[model samples]
Target: MLIAQISDPHVRPAGQLYQGVVDSNRMFEEAIAHLHALDRRPDLVLLTGDLVDEGRSEEYAEARRLLAKLSIPYLVIPGNHDHRENFRTAFADHAYLPATGALHYCIDTHPVRIVALDSCIPGLHHGHVDAEGLAWLQRTIEADREKPTLLMLHHPPFTSGIPYMDSYRYIDTAPLEAIVRSVGNIELVLCGHVHRTMLKRWAGTVVCSCPSSTTEIALQLAPDAAPASYLGRPGCMLHLWDEAQGMVSHVSYIGKMDGPYPFA
Candidate 1:
């Protein structure tokens, strides 16, 4: 099975730009187009969060309008920029989402199992999974200990050297890490919110944080580095799963580029 992961689209209303500058909606359109143009079509698409810029209904409407161009099966979880109720109402047709509380669920139909966690702290930018959410995860993962699983959450589990961004990560990760460490069947833990590509070996598996479809967060490692971002080579994550290869991931950049030259 193959899955394409796109994060932090931050879609604005029609005629508006993300943060009133970058044309994130158009960029997201390009990302959808890129996915559609892949050599081998993906069986599913995973949207890691921040679907809309400000959690507004109009933004979600515009997002849905742009999303009309995509025809693949996709799953989405809320990010800090998303309002839970508004997001829930926006995708009301997605029956997999819980009717109330955190937007966490598990999908078992594919060759690889998918478990998505809602990490947003309502009106706050930082994230956390309360005891209730963690309890649900523990039960879900514990129920099926042998499936090739992927854990999806908005926040990457490690403290990325991007100091400014790390300030907004999920608080108190000890418990979540414990649950993940207890499970050996989880092939990878996929995340977003850092807006740049990141990888780490964690909990006896791999954790991959995808780049945004709109902007690339500056990779500053200094302790006092200030927050900054740019509209650079926006990209997404392509995860391929097979019995022999397991989960192999690649960062697929968007927009046109000079390539396919013969090996000299």
Candidate 2:
């Protein structure tokens, strides 16, 4: 099974740019085209979060229009920039998303079981999964302990070295970590919101934070470096699962670039 992960397009209304610089809508279009052109098309696409910029109805409408172009099936979770109600109403056809309360859901797809948790706190930049949310997650994972599972969420449980981004890292992650440790079936934890590709090992599973589809956060490791982004090549992660190898991930950069030169 092939699963593609795209994150943080931050789509805005028509004729608008994200942060007055990146052309997010256009970038997303290019990303979708890239996915469509893949030789081995993805079986499923996991859009981690930040589906829109302002979380407005119009933006979601535009997002729906753009995402509709995808030939592959996809699922979405809310991010810090996303409004729960707006997101729920925008993608109401998903059926997987809960009609009320948190947008947490579980998918029992072939080869892997996906458990997406709602980590967004309305009107806040930080993320938290309350005790109630944690209970749901525990129950969901415990029910199917034998299946290989991928736990998806918006905010990462670990902090990126980028000081600016780490400042607002997910709060109250200990409980979530403990749950994963106890369940022992989570193969990986997928996240977005850092706008950069990051990998870490926690609770006996790999946690991967994907880069943005629009722009990339500058790789400034300095504690005092200002928060900023660059128009570097955007990308997505492709996860391949096989009975022999289990799951492996690869990053595919968007847009046409240098040739695949052969080494003599």
Candidate 3:
């Protein structure tokens, strides 16, 4: 099955801009339109995190409107910018995130099982997976050991080398590592909170963090990194997987800009 993994949309209301330079809502609209235009649409659209700009009701209301236009099924977990209650309100009809108010859930999606975790620490920018969430994750993975499962969360369990961003990652990773080590069927860990794309591995599972569709974080050297912005590209990933073929992911940036293939 093919899954479209879109992360860190950071969507604001229409015509609402963040700072003087970021037209986040417009960027997200363009990206969603791109997905709708795809010839062979994805089987599912998995939004890793950052559904709203500031966890505001209006922001999520606008977000809901834009996302509702997608033709295929979609699932979203909470990011640092999302409030659990507001997120639940926006996705009230989603089976995984019931109206009961919990922002986490697990689903058996054909060949793959997906476990979505809520790592948002409410008002904090940094993230953590508390004992309850961890326990649920352990039980969830243990229940379905044969299927190739994917764990989606808002924070990476490891450092991404971009020091500024790394500081805001999951504060405690030992417990997460233990759970991942025990679950042999976990194929990948998908996350997005750093506003930049990064890939790492933990307990033999691939940990991937995709870039924000609106922009990107600068790739900076540690000592000199000093909280800065790079304004890189707007993009998303296409994840292809099956029992026979396994999981393969391709990252693509928006091609609306006229330019030559720089690498070639």
Candidate 4:
């Protein structure tokens, strides 16, 4: 199975630029086109979070229109930029999602079991998981210990060194980390709030944060650095999974670039 992970498109309404600068919707469209053009089409796609610039109905409408072009099936979780209720209403057709409360569920049809957790705090930029949400996650993972599981959430559990971005990082860590550490079958904990590709060995498994489909948050580690992002080369993560081989992730950069010149 091949899964494509794209994050933080921050799509704006039609004819509008995201943050009054970059055309994120068009970039997201290109990212979808990129997925379609791949030699092997992805079996599934995961939109990590921040699907729109704002939690407006129009933004979700535009996002829905652009996402309709994707031929592959996809799953979405809410980010701080997304309004929980609006997101739920926008993708009401996705029966896997819960009708009320947190947008959390488990999918077992795929080769890997996907346990997506809702980490958004409604009206806040930071993320948190209440006792009920955490308990749900623990029970969901415990249900299938033999299956290769991928835990999906919007915010990364660890504090990224990036000063500004870390300001809005996930707040419920200790308990969550304990839960993940005890789960033996969790193959990967996938996240997207950081907007840049990041990897870390945590809780007996790995956490891979997908890159943004639009602008990338600048990699500034200085404490005094200001919050900023740039219209950099957008990209996505293609995860190839096989029963024997496990999973190997490759980064596929979007837009035109240099040729596939032979290194040999």
Candidate 5:
């Protein structure tokens, strides 16, 4: 199984730029084009969050239009930037985005189980997985242990070691840790909201985050670092899974650049 992950497009109502720097709409289109052009098309496209900047109905509508170009099946989750009601209203026809419940779901994809958990807290930049989401996650993972599971959510459960990002990471992680430790089948925990590629480990499972399609956050390695944002390269993550080889995840940036040739 192959999965293409796109995060935090932050698309506006009319392909408008964000903060006069990020062309989110165009970047999203380029990312989709890159996905389609891959040698092996993905089985599914998992959009982590922040599909829109403000979660407006128009933004969702616009997102729907942009996403329609992709031939692969896809699923979306709400981020701190997204409005839950708007998400439901926009994706009413989708079987996964129901009109009710916690906005969290568990999907069984044969040898692989994809669990989309809602970690967004209303009116806040940071996020957390509440008790309800935690319970659902625990039960679902406990029920299935042999299958390779990939947990997807908008907020990462661990800190990215960056100043601005670490402060806003999933606030309550004890329960999350317990759940992950008990599950044993969780191979990868995928998340967004940081707007940069990050790798971490939690409960023996690999935690990975992809860069936003629109913008990239500057990497800050020092503690007590100031909140500094960047206009770095836009990118996404591609996850390849196989029964024999296990799971492989890689990062790809969106842009045209020439590479040095050894022969030349």
Candidate 6:
């Protein structure tokens, strides 16, 4: 099975732009068009987080409208920029999401099982998985140990070198780490919120952060480099799972590029 992961669209209202620069809605439109045009379309799409620039109801409504155009099934989790209530209300058809409390659920598709964890702390930019949330995760993973599982959350569990972004890294990771190490079937931990593509080995599994569908965080790794972003190549992660190769992920940049020139 093939799964496409898109994150950090940060979709703004119809007439507004994200951060006064990015036309996030347009970017998402292009991203969706790219997905639809793929020769081998994905079985499903996983939207990690940051669905909108603000947690406004109208923003969520706009995001929902755009996402509805996808031909394949899709799932979404809350990010720091998302308001749980608004998101739940907007995507009411997504029954996996809890009506109240944290938005967490387990999806059992054909080849793999997806365990989505809610790491968003309301009214806060940083992320945190409290004891309760961690406990839920532990129980969920422990219950299904044989399935090839993928853990999805909005925040990266490890510290990224980007100082400005690292400051908002997920807090209280020890519990989640312990759970992940204990459960050997977890194939990958998928994350967003940094607005850039990053990969790290943690807790006996690979953690990959998908680049934003709208604008990308500058790859500034210096200790003092301030936070900045640009409209670089928007992208998504395509994960393929099969009996032979297990799970393989590829970064697919959106939009058309130059010709497929021969290597000389």
What local distance difference test score does each model get?
A: 0.94, 0.92, 0.82, 0.92, 0.86, 0.91
lDDT of 6 by residue, 90-163 (tens): 98888888889999999986689999999999999888888888888989999989999999999999988999
Tens digit of lDDT per residue, candidate 3, span 1-264?
888888888888677876558988777777788777776688888898888888889998889888777777888998998888888877777867856634778989567888898888878888888888889889989997888988889898887787888778798899989998996898888888877667887877888887788878888867657877756788887888877889988786764766657786
RMSD after CA superposition, every candidate: 0.9, 1.1, 2.3, 0.9, 1.8, 1.2
Residue-wise C-alpha lDDT for candidate 4, range 1-264, written one tens digit per residue: 999999889989999998889999899999999999999999999998899978999999999999899999999998899989999999999999899999999999999988999999988999899999999998988888899999999999998999999999998699999999887989899999898999999999999999999989999999999999988889999988899999888889999988889985
Ordered list by lDDT, greatest first? 1, 4, 2, 6, 5, 3
Show the colliding residue pairs in model 1: none
State every prediction's TM-score relative to the real structure: 0.98, 0.98, 0.93, 0.98, 0.94, 0.97
Candidates 4 and 6, the one with greater lDDT: 4
As for TM-score, the candidate ahead, 1 or 6, is 1
Error of 6 at 100 (Å): 0.8
Off by over 4 Å in 1: none
Q: Where does model 6 exceed 4 Å of error?
A: 262-264
Residue 254 deviation, candidate 6, in Å? 0.3
lDDT (Cα, tens digit) per residue for candidate 5, span 1-264 = 889999999988875787667778888989999998888988988999999998889888889899889888888899989999898888887787656866888889556789889888888878888787788888888888999999999998887778778777788788888889986789899999999888887888999998999877778789877876777788889999999999999998887778846785
- What are the runs in model 3 whose C-alpha is more than 4 Å off? 100-102, 257-264
The residue-level lDDT of candidate 5 at 18 comes to: 73
Better of 2 and 5 by lDDT: 2
Candidate 3, clashing residue pairs?
none
The superposed Cα distance between candidate 6 and the true structure at residue 253, in angstroms, equals 0.3
After superposition, the stretches of candidate 2 with alpha carbons farther than 4 Å from their true spots are none
